[model samples]
Every structure is written in C-alpha cells, then in structure tokens.
Target: MPGALTGIRVIDLTQMLAGPYCTMMLADHGAEVIKIEPVEGDPTRRFGPFPEDDTERHFGGYFQGTNRNKLSLTVDLKKPEGRDILIRLARDADVLVENFRAGVMDRLGVGYETLASENPRLVYAAIRGFGDPRTGESPYVDRPAFDVVAQAMGGAMGITGPDAATPMKVGPGIGDIFPATLAAFGILAAHRYAMVTGQGQFLDVAMYDGIVSLCERAVYQYSYTGRPPVPEGNQHPILCPFGMFPALDGRVTIACPRDSFWTELVTVMGRPELASDPRFRTNADRLQNSAQTVEIVESWTRQLTKAQIGQALGVRVPYGEVNTAADIFADPHLKAREMLVEVEHPGSARPVTIASTPIRMTATPGGVVQRAPLAGEHNDRILAGCGFSASNIAQLRESGVIS
Candidate 1:
C-alpha cells in the first residue's frame, strides 16, 4: 500500500513558523507538498541561525526544523499569473495551507471560498494568530501577532511565572507550534472525512486559541476556585513536588501526580514521616502545604545528582533530568528513540542534528529526508514539470515572476 498520504498533494503558501510547520507535518507523511514561496522567497530563508554558507538563502535551524521533504516553487503572488498558477494547483491539490493575516488571502483572491468554488473537494486549512476571521473574527484580528503575542494574549503568560505579579511567557513558540499542530490534526481529520464523503471543508486554527487551550488548567482553577493562578515555574499549581528541583550537579524534575507515587517518593527520600503528617498527609493536605512539601523534597534532591534522583524515583514518580541541547545530544534514550536527525548543510559541510518527527507508525514510518531547500532552489525544475517550457521559465525569471 502507499504511504499514509502518498496520493495527497498540498499547496503550501505559508512562511515562517506556524503554517510551514503544519504543511511540513503533512509532507513527512508522504504527501506531495509543493511549498510555494514569493519570488523573493520565504523570509525565513534569511532568518538566522544560518549555516556558514556563501549562498544568499539557506536553512536557518528554525526553517530546517519545520520544513523538509517538500518541493520548492517560487511565484510572484502579487501578479495575476502567479495567482492563476496557485489556483490551478489548488484545483488539483488535496489541501491548501496558508497563514496570512486575516484578510490577506481573501484580498489576494485565493481564500477558501474562492478555491473551494473551483474544487469542492479541497481542504483549505489556515492558521492565524487569533480571531480566525473565516470562523469568528477575533477582536484582535486586525492586530498583528507573533509567537509571544499569542502566548501572552492567550493566557499562557498569565500563569507561567512565579506569581500573578510576574506573569511569564512560555519559553518556546507555544503559539505557533501548538496551533500548527492543531491545524495539522484538523487537516488530517479533514482529509479522512473528505476521502469518505468526497467533499472538502475549511479548517480554521488560531494560535491564540491553541495557546489558550494549553493554559486550560489555569482556566479550570480560576473558574472553579475564583483564584488567579500563579506560575510555579515548571511545576504544576496543584501538584506539589511536580516540578524542577535542584540537584547536586544539575536540576531534575519529579512528579507525584498520584498518591501512591507521593508515598513512594517520600519513602525513598527517607522522609516517610511526610507521608503521615496531617499537614502533608493526603494530596489535598500536600497541596495546602505545597511550598513546604516542595522545599522538603528539594532538600533531599539537592544532595543527589540529577541522574541519581531520576534513578531513585524511577518512572514510578515520573522523574527526569533537566537536560540541555548538549545534554540531549548526548542522551542515550533520545538516541534509542531516533529522535535526533542529521542533515547536511552546504556551508557547514557537515551534518547537524535536528529533532525528528514525534509520531511513530509501523506501516509507513516518517522522518526528515532533507535539509530545507534554498530560496526557489527547485523553482525552474518544478515549473518545468508544471508544463512550462524551459524558455518560459527563463522568461518568467527575467520578468521577475520568479527568481
């Protein structure tokens, strides 16, 4: 049988993080993804951390992380001819993914409504900052948003720091990655549905909405207890001893989400008394005295190395060392899982490892097959395959229709 999406074709007109990541997921699963870029190219091609390359456009680690296993094509979408090509591709493509601002795609006449009219079986998926206009326009739809904007506005920042007085934004691109993942899930679901019914639909995924979901625990706390949630800094607000604690050499995390695990942890720490003390007995009591409980736990943990802490706790209490990228690079578990992938960059002249696809499928496994394409690197070849003559491609390049 073919790989999961071998017959599917994706027209990717996305740049930067969110939409690129969504389409990249599709590509990893054997989708024929044609990543369309502006004639100048996707801005990320210039965004660092660029390799030591002489070429003008190449992989930034960020771009390489998200975009791979996809063909590259360049077009000037500002012109009618370029838009026409996109329309033609969309008519035959299984999906179209975009992440333009609220009205940009519609203004360009390539929005869902326009394409769906021509190809009723096309899955038009979009990622937006917030206020996905196609569904319900957010009040902030007109405002521009980046990763941090979505994290902060969507409540991720409100309860991620030490206290209400010092709300902190999440460290990663929570906004882009979460919504991109959600959008990919929606696209896959839509693809399944379209295969069954032969009728495609629009998918609207908002980064802010996704980040909001990520902070839903805070929502539950505030709505139920009427208390503003405070950041515990890598710890859960409700679960004591459920976060990072200092170790002799480095830090590690310990989680006691279950009563039995708590009992086991305190027992191992030679603090079995904590298991019966009225102020620290049950989970509820522990929550009430969370600071003291964590302090006590950390006091024990501080004497041991992170590895020792993890070994003592075992998966029985879900403990792990706080590893850096260097630590990750040296990790045996990650190596066993094949989670680190090596791809060669032109300038580096050596392979650099990036994270691998997280999902595992026995039937048709997915992986990073290549580094990101340079700006319009495959433009001529792809356009020629689209049935343009060699001279026509050259003419388009000469006319600035493509670089």
Candidate 2:
C-alpha cells in the first residue's frame, strides 16, 4: 500500500539530529525526501557504532537510524550554481527543511522567502537553537547551539537531576528529538493549510523553546507556588508512591494518585489497613507523609524481585520495571508490536536492528522500506528529476557544484 505522504516531495537541507529526524518522520510516512549534503556529508555519517568487520563505512549507526527512507544528493550551496540547483529542486517540492543557524540559508541565497518565491505553496521549515528572526527575533538568534545547550537553557536540565544543585543533561537527545517531532507536526499542519489555501508559509521551531514546552509542569508549578521547581529525585512532587521503588533484583515504578488505586496497592502489599490510616488514606494525606509512604512501599517491594512485584501488582495498579536495553530486547511486547526491525547493513553480513515507526495506519501504512543512502547516491536521479540532463549533471560535477 502507498504511504500517507506518498506524493509529497521534500527537499531536506539538514544535518545532524534535529532536522534529519524531522524529515525522517516524513520520509517514513512516504515522503520523497531528498537529503542535500555538502561534500563532507552530514557529520553523523561518520558517527560510530559500526559493525566490527565493516570497512566500507558508507554510514554509521547514527546516520542509519535517522536517515533511512531518504534519497541523498550532494550539492555545494556555496556555489551560485549549487544554490540554483536547490532553488530549482524547491520549485516543485511540497516542503523544504533545514537546521542551519538562523540567517545561514539566507546568506546562501536559499532562505524561505527566496524559495517561496519559486513555489508559492512551498512549506519552508527551519529548526534552530533559538528561532528565526522572521517569526520572532530571539536574543540568542545568532548563537549556535546543540542538544545540551537547549536542555540547560530551556528548563529541562533545571528540573531533571536528583537535586537542584547538580543539574544533569538527559541521557537521550530529547532537546533535539522533541523539537524534531514538533517540527514534523508543524510541517504537516502547514502543509495541510497550503493544500487547502494554495499558499505556504515559513515555520520555525526553536530547540530551546521545545525543551521549555516539554518542561511545562515546571512552568505551572512556579506560577502556582511562586517558587521555581527543583528536581525531587525519583518521586513526583505531588503524588505519593508515584516513582521508582527498590526491588530485590532491580527498581520498579508504582503510581497511585487515586484513593482506590492506593487501596488496591496496600491490599496487594499485605497491609490493607494502611489504606485507612490517617497518614496514608487519601492522596493528600499520603503526600504529607510521603516519606513514610515510600518506606512502607519499599519494605514490600524490596522483598520481591521485579518479576515478583509485577506478578503481585498484575493489572490492578500502575507499575513498570525499569527496562534496560537488554530487557527491552527480550520483551515479548516489543516483538508483538513489531517495534524492533532489522535492516541490511551495507558492508556487514549481519543485519542491524533499529526501531520501527510507531505510527500505524490501516489504509496507508508507513515504515522503513529502504536503507539510508550512500553519499550522493541519488544525485543523478534527483538532478534529473529537477530537469537537469545527464550532460548537465556531469558538468555540474566537473565544476565542483556537486560531488
């Protein structure tokens, strides 16, 4: 079956994580994403975790994981001819996405205004550290930033660690990934508007802004209490027993924000009377005596392994074991859901496993149907589609406009 964005053509002029990930989402759902790389290629193409014996090094794990289902075209946007090529490609493209620092594309002569002139219905999107001036001028507009900067500046790191004094960056690149996810949604929404009105607009997503949005709870907490929220370790600030607890083997999480669930948890813990105790009866009471509540929960949980605790809680309470990668790989639920998928490695005999798209559709299902492309792998094809002849492409390559 054809995918959801089967007919949509995307001109992807992005590198690294944020922009590539956003375009990857579109490509996974059947957009014809053309990734325009410089001669050196996206820096991630050299990123590691390659198979032990693989020597070709066409792409590494980071590139493969995010750049799948996209075509590769190398163009030197520094050159006027290369800029012309991009403009020509965008003339008919449904969308164009980039993640350069604000004003870089405009300096290269392919900014949204220039492209929108070529295609009135083109949805030109940018992912930046702060944001583009066209949307709203940011004080840090010209500053370069990455995931860690966004985390620190945007409140995620402020409320992430065990304590307020020791802020810690998140393990995953949520700063980039979350903004990418939002950008994908924004692009789709803008594209839908363009399809209806025949007018496309430029859209921007600031990495800092995205992280602030993700830390929304912190904002409301400060607003209500007039005190900036601090990291409260593993437990939630308001709910009792709503965090990680120790098990005989590992850690497990239990959440009981409701009285009924709290009652059910105590009953399972072999302490049904605690459900009626003044210190732990209602959610508010449990909140006031949270330390005692945690001690009681831990006393029961520490006596059981994660599996044992899971079996005891079963489906009555909200619970989950802290899952490591090994645990996830061995989980029957991941297998049942087809979340893990294997793709052919370019130079290795063993196929590499990567996560599959979670979006499922009955009529137009989308997924990883192709591997990440080799650098400039589809240059000829993409150029041809842009109305350049074989001789023209050869000349462009000879002139150092393309690799």
Candidate 3:
C-alpha cells in the first residue's frame, strides 16, 4: 500500500536529532526523503554503540535510530558542482529541510529564496535555535544551541525537578524532537497550501520557542498567580495525590483530581469514612493539605506491592506504575500495541529492536519500513535520477565532489 505522503519528496540537509526526526516522520509515511550528507557524513554516524567485532565503524545506533526510512546522498556542498546538484534536486522537491546556523545556506547561495525561485511551490523549512531572519530576528541568532540550552531558556527546566533550588533536564531530547514534530506539521501545512496556490514560503522553527510552547502551562500560571511556579517533586502543583507514590517494592502514580475519583480512591484505601473529612473533602482542600494527603495514601500504599494496589484500585481512577525501560520491554500492553519493532542491524547478524511510529491508520499505517541508509549509499541512484549521466557521476566522484 502507498503511504499518505508517497508522492512527496524531501531534500534532507540536516544532521543530528531535530531535523532528522522531522524527515523521519515524513519518510515513514511514504515520502521520498533523500538525505544529503556532507562528504564526511552526518556527525551522528560516529555516535556509537558499535558492534563489538566490527572494525569499520559503518554507523552507530544514534544515526540509525532516527535516519531509518530515508535515502542517502553525499555531496561536498563546498564545491560548486556539488552545490549545483542540490539546486537541481530542489527544482523538483516538495520540501527542503536544513538545520545549519543562520545564513549558512544563503552564504552557500541555496537559501529558501534561491530555491523558491527554482520551484515556486517548494516548502523551504529551516530548523534553528533562534529561527531565520526572514521570519524574525534574535540577538542570539548567530549563537548555536542544543537540547540543554533550549530546555533551560524555554521554561521547561524552571519547573521540572525536585524543587526550586534544583532544575533538571528532561530525559528525552524533547527540545529538539518537539520542534521537529511541529516542523513536520508546518511542512505538511505549507505543502498543502502550495499545492493549492502554487506559492512557496519560508518557514522556521526555533527550538527555544518550541520548548516555550511546550511549557505553556507555566506561562499562564505565572500570569494568573504573579508567582513563578516551583517544582513540587513528583507531585502536581494543582492536583493532590496526582503524582508518584511509593509502593511496597516500587512507585506508582494515582490521580484523583475530582471529588468522585477521590472518594473512590479513599474507599479503595479502606477509609470510606474520610470521604467527608474537612481536610480531604474537596480537591481544593486536598491541594492545600497535599502533604497530609500523600501521607494518608502512602500509609496504605507502602504496605502493598504496586501490582496489589493496581489490582485493588482497578479502573475506577487513573493509575500506573513507574515503569522502567525493562518493564516497558516486558509490558503486554506495548506488545499488543505493536510499539516495539525489529529491524535489521547494519553490519551485525543479530537484528535490533526499536520503537515504531506511534501513528496508526487502518489502510495506510506508517512505520520504520526501511533501515537507515549507509553513508552515500544512494549516490548513483539519486544523481542518475536527477539527470546526471554515468560519466558525469564518475567525474564528480573523481573530483571529490560526490562520494
């Protein structure tokens, strides 16, 4: 079956996580994503968990995890002939994604304006730390940013840890991945508009701004209370008993933000009489005395295993254990949902299992149908399709323009 984006073509000039993640989504849904790497390849090819016996470092888990379902083409963008090849590809591409620092593409003479002239319906999307000047300017535009920088400046770190005195970065690279998700949607929206109106536009996603959008609750909460919200450990600032609590062997999260659920939870705790108690009668009262409420819950939970508590509580309230990676790997629910998939390892006899795309469609489900391409693996095929003769390709390779 054809994917939803089967007809779309993406010129991927991105490295590392953020940009590649966006293109990965597009490719998973059947877009022809041609990853244009530098002659040295994406830096992540060196980020490893390399096979123990492998002498040649073909690639690593970091690159393979995200770059799956795409074609690879190597070009020396510093060389005129190589840069010209990208321009030719852009002439027919539906989207071009790049994550270089500000003005790098323009300096190379392949900025959005240059490509939009070639294919007016092109969606030239750029992902940057601060965004492109064509959209808005930032004093920090020239400065580079990474996931940690985005998390710190974007308000996520301000309210994510044990307390106000300590802030923690999120485990996942959400600073990059979130912006990539937003960029994928933006690209699709722009592609739709171009198909209808025959006009292309420059779109940009700033990682800092993306994380700010992700932390929108903090923005409104600060405005409403005139006080910066502080981290409350594993507890929710507004909802009582809606965070992690210790079990006999581990921890579980039980949420009962409403009176009915709270009443049910207290009943399951074998303390039905406390339902109307003044300190725990309503959500607001419980929030005011959250510490006491946690004690009341933990006093019962600490005696029981997480499984025992879950089985007793049943489905009357939102409840879950604090699952580790191994727990997830063994979870029946994940298996039923087909969340884990096996892919062929690049240079190993043993296959590797990785997370599949979360999206599901009855007729056109999207997933990691292909493994990540070896560096410059599709050079001849991609270039020949772009009208390069065999001799031309050989000469380009000989001259160190293409690899």
Candidate 4:
C-alpha cells in the first residue's frame, strides 16, 4: 500500500533513541527507510530486554520499540569502499539522518555538502547533544551525549521532582523524543522547500535546545516576579485541591480550577458547607488553605477507588485517575484508539505488545506490517535495490565491510 511519504528514501545512520525515532516517524508515514549500521551493527543491538536467551542470536525490546517498518543494512564506513558505496546510496536518497559526533560523516567522505552535491533535493539532517557541524560546530561537539545529559542540562531536571531538594528525571526519554520531533518538523519543512525550489538544505536539532523548548513555559511565575519556580510535588502552586490525592487503591490526581468545579467536588464529597465557608469559597482563599482543603477532599476520596473518583468527576470537573502500567495496558480508551499493537518478534514465538502510533489518517492509515528486523537482516535487500549484483555484494560481505 502506498503511504503518504511512499516515494521518499531515508538513509538512517542513527542508533539508540533519537535518530532512529525520527526515522521511524518517516517510515510510519510511508518513507522507504534504510538503516545503515557498522559491521558490528548498531550498539542498540547489544542493548537488552532480549526476546530470547541464546548462545548467539538475540534482539532487545528497546530496539524493537523504536524501529519498525524499516529495512536494514550494514556497511563499515571506516572502509574506503564502504564510503564509496554510501556516497552512491546518497544520490537517490531523499534524506540522510545521522546522530554521530559532528565530524563523523565528514571524516568518512559522506557529509551533507558532498552528498547534497549529487542530490540537490536531499534533506540532510543531524541530531546532536548540543548542536551539529552545520550550526558552527560547538567546542563540545566531540562529546557524545544521551538522554540523561540533555535532560540534566536543558532545564528539565531543575523543574522536575518535589520540593526542589532532590531533583528527579522525567519518567520517559523526552530528551530524545523532543529532538526527534523537531527533526521531523525540519524534514517536512525542507521537503516543502525542495518541492518548490529544487534545493536541499541541512536540518539540525540539538537535544539540549529541544529540551529547553519543551520546558519553555516552566517560568510562568518567575518571568513576571523574578522568583524562580520551585517544585511543589503533585500540587499546582496556586490551585487549591487541584493535585494528587490518596484514594482507596492509590493516588488519584484531581483538578478543580474554577469555584463552580470546586463546589461540585465538595458536593460530591457531601461537603456543601465547606464550599459555602468563606475560607474556602474562592480559589485564592482555598489556595491559602490548600493543605486543609486537600485533606478535606482526601477524607472522602480515601474511601473511594481512582475509578470511583474518575467516574464521579468525568466531564463534571477535570480529573484523571493515576494509572500504573497494568491500568494503562487494560485501558478501554487505548484499545479503542489502537494505542497498543501486538507484533511477533523474529526470534520469539510469542508476540510483544507495545505502544501504538499516535498518528491517524482518514486515508492511507498504517499499521504494524512486519516485525523489527534482525541485525543486518536486509543488508542485501537494501543494497541490491541500489544496483549491486549478487557477486559484488558477496565480495563486499567477504571484505568484512558488512556483517
């Protein structure tokens, strides 16, 4: 089936979370993504949550989660012949995405300037810890960074966690996701430009910059008051009874921004008199006594399940039941929206259940069509499409250029 990006070809030279994630989004929309790995393969291959325990063959859950609906290839870029072949592949590729240290591709003779010379319509993209070469390579560009480094330096760590005493990291790898999303946007922009002007351009996204963009609104109070924001745990600083409360089962986060919702909430708990009380009548007044207000709310909520609170508050006041992995896995809304899909791993008999795509199209909707590839599984298949013969591919394999 033809996808939205069906005619596009992306040469993905990224591993781990950020780069592969960007390419996956392109593939999800119908790009022909050919992931190029070193002879030993992407380091992610060695990462675990392996499908099967074996003396030899293994694949990890992280690898499977990000990489799907993409073909794979292996080429040792350190080798001159391998570099030659990569340049050839670049000619027909619509985009080239790399997350290596700034000079890695330039050193291998496959940098954007060289690649784009042959393919003027190519969108060359790079993801980096700080920024990339085309952005005037930073002095720290040589230092490679993963999600944790970006999160720590990019203002995310400063705002997370409770009380500002022990700052905590975000639960997911947003450091990678943010950069990938920005890169995807850049790619689309470049694609539009190429369609009009027949000129390709470099698109670069720094993980640290991406993280800062995501946390842009963190200083809502500080920007006006010159007072830095501090963590107030699950509580919103100015909103009364608008945070996490203990339920019979666990925590249920509730929010009642307006006095009307607070009145309804108080009524739900049979506390009409408390809603009428001058000390808790308005949001400002209630914020002054939030601790007492939450205790009052929890006094009733403690006897109920999160589901009970969610049911009582649904559409009446904004509330969400704090859910664990099990709760999310069993969520009816997620099932209805196709937010979970099952795919059989190449090395496993049983299927793996993973989060599904968030993209939805009225036409040309895509689903999980195949399992994530085994390491270098499509080396021949991808290279053969670029016009390599069987004997040449065999010789290249023999030269230890590919695994």
Please, what are the lDDT tens digits per residue for candidate 1 over residues 1-403? 3457788999998988888888888888788889998877788877677666535446677777887788888899888878877887787889999888888988988888999998999999988887566688678887877899998888888877876578887778878989999999999999889999999999888888898888888789889999877766767777776888899998988888888888899889988887888998777888898889889998899999887887887766778888888999999988998999998775676677788888878998877777778778888777766677898878888888888
Q: Using Cα atoms with residue i matched to residue i, what is each candidate's TM-score against the true structure? A: 0.95, 0.98, 0.98, 0.93
Clash list (residue pairs), candidate 1: 131-138
Candidate 1 lDDT (Cα, 0 to 1): 0.83
lDDT of 2 by residue, 1-403 (tens): 6899999999999988999999999999999999999966877899989998899998889999999999999999999999999999999999999999998998888888899999999999999999999999888999999999999999988887887787889999999999999999999999999999999999999999999999999999999999998877888888888999999999999999889999999999889999899999898999999889999999999999999999999999999999999999999998998888899879888999888899989898798898899999999999998789999999999998888
Which regions in candidate 2 have their CA more than 4 angstroms from the true location?
none
Error of 4 at 180 (Å): 1.4
Query: For model 2, how many clashes?
Result: 0
- C-alpha lDDT of residue 48 in model 4: 74
- Alpha-carbon local distance difference test for all models: 0.83, 0.93, 0.92, 0.85
Report the lDDT of model 1 for residue 396.
Answer: 83
If ranked by lDDT, best first, what sequence of candidates would result?
Answer: 2, 3, 4, 1
Tens digit per residue, CA lDDT, model 3, 75-141: 9998999889999999999999999999999999898888888999999999999998999989989
Backbone clash total for model 4 is: 0
Lowest summed-lDDT stretch of 10 residues in model 1? Answer: 50-59
Clashes per prediction?
1, 0, 0, 0
Q: Candidates 1 and 2: which is better by TM-score?
A: 2
